[model samples]
Target: MNTPLNLAALVLALSAALTSAPALAHGEAHAGAQAQEVVKEQKPWGIAGDADQVDRTIEVSMTDQMRFIPDRIEVKLGETIRFVHRNQGRVLHEFVLGTKQDLDEHAAMMVKFPGMEHDEPYMAHVGPGKREEIVWTFNRAGEFDFACLIAGHYQAGMVGKISVSPTN
Candidate 1:
């Protein structure tokens, strides 16, 4: 094959590998370990919940400009909410729930491993014009955070806030 054709094949192979490597790398074993940790204690972010038990559903949009419409959200404590994520942009996006510190750390890791893929109850990875969902229970009464920790997406302002008001 000519040099140009060889380079083209290599580029295509690398692209495919980058896109699917994270899913193939993180499997059931990884989820099992995360689940075990979740049972140990609740993180500051929030906890995953059953979809059928959700108290309400919120529609969120991830746009090409790296922004989440309604960047700030309010929720009641102990309420389970279903997030309908729509990637109405031209690039890949994600909705990940975490605290400021948690998101910062995760974002840094994502920068290091651009191909990393993770499936968490507080997260939804959506392709352009695609939709995804996340069901979570805001059991704690504190402020939390969510972001699209995909490479430079978070830094590009694709972040949101969740205020969990204390219940009576």
Candidate 2:
């Protein structure tokens, strides 16, 4: 009788342990889920700068063959540029300014979102035959590439360079 009671007690304890193990594991996973929620809540809307205080103006034209007419733009550091970008192409085009690596990364991200576009602080876009404007200030002097993020556009030579020189 004593041995039977001991076995029954041990079996009950083992069953309880098995049941509680999953609950504890689930609790840990729930904490991880809450942490992820917090992280997502803290995510930022990546747009930068206000559109006031434009210093200089520029006119850029895009052609039907996916090309920028002036492949090189010259600017001075700390100068504000008001860009008039026009897309004369049959398809859509974007005038984006960034480093080569930035353009590559942006192009990769752009490929993932069909019909979704990202206009950076220093960039703008105008549909076919339409014109858009953007005013941005170049704080640093560097060689930045301007490219159209539409599919296969950059590869087809829809890219240009902006040379920002030091203010003398």
Candidate 3:
């Protein structure tokens, strides 16, 4: 009698344990699905890059109010960037990538050009509703600043930061 009772108790415990396994797995699967949905929604405005690619592309649009839609950018060291800049502003605009010191130096040089130097590879003075593009590579990891060289533009918060991380 004692032996039969002990066997029955063991069987019951094993069955309960087996039933709970599926429930735990189902809960994990549900959580994973929710995380995937969030990633898909935020991907368009997010910075994406491939370490193996020769050039990574970033699209930036400028408005008359002096703002970049995505004000921050991220990249890995040794990655090349292809920047597509569009001017949706009433006045001219530019997208220049360099250090704070480099921007200051170049900004001074821009004054030498009459009105604004609208035609340069690293600089652009695109008029309203116009678009321009530039490709550059980052050989090292550091904080880089980008801005419009037009007078009073940088002072009006037309600046942004780029973060580069160490390559894997």
Candidate number achieving the greatest lDDT relative to the actual structure: 1
Pick by TM-score: 2 or 3, better one: 2
Instruction: Write the residue-wise lDDT of candidate 3 on 48-165 in tens digits.
Output: 2233454667889998788886779998876777777877777777787767887888677655653531332344445677776555566667788888767667768888888988
TM-score of 3: 0.61
Residue lDDT tens for model 2, 80-150: 78777877876666787778888788777666754553333445655667776655567767787888876
Model 1 residue runs over 4 Å out of place are 1-41
Cα lDDT of candidate 1 equals 0.79
Best-to-worst order by TM-score is: 1, 2, 3
For model 2, what is the error of residue 54's alpha carbon versus the real structure, in angstroms, after optimal superposition?
Answer: 2.6
What would you estimate as the lDDT of candidate 2? 0.66
Clashing pairs in 1: none
lDDT by residue (1-168, candidate 1, tens digit) is 499999999999999988874343322222333334333236786688776799999999989888999899999999999999988988878888889998999999988987674556666777778787777888888889989888888898889999999887
Q: How many backbone clashes does candidate 2 have?
A: 0
Q: Single out the weakest 10-residue window by summed lDDT for candidate 3.
A: 37-46
Q: Name the regions of candidate 2 deviating beyond 4 angstroms.
A: 1-52
How do the candidates rank by lDDT, highest first? 1, 2, 3
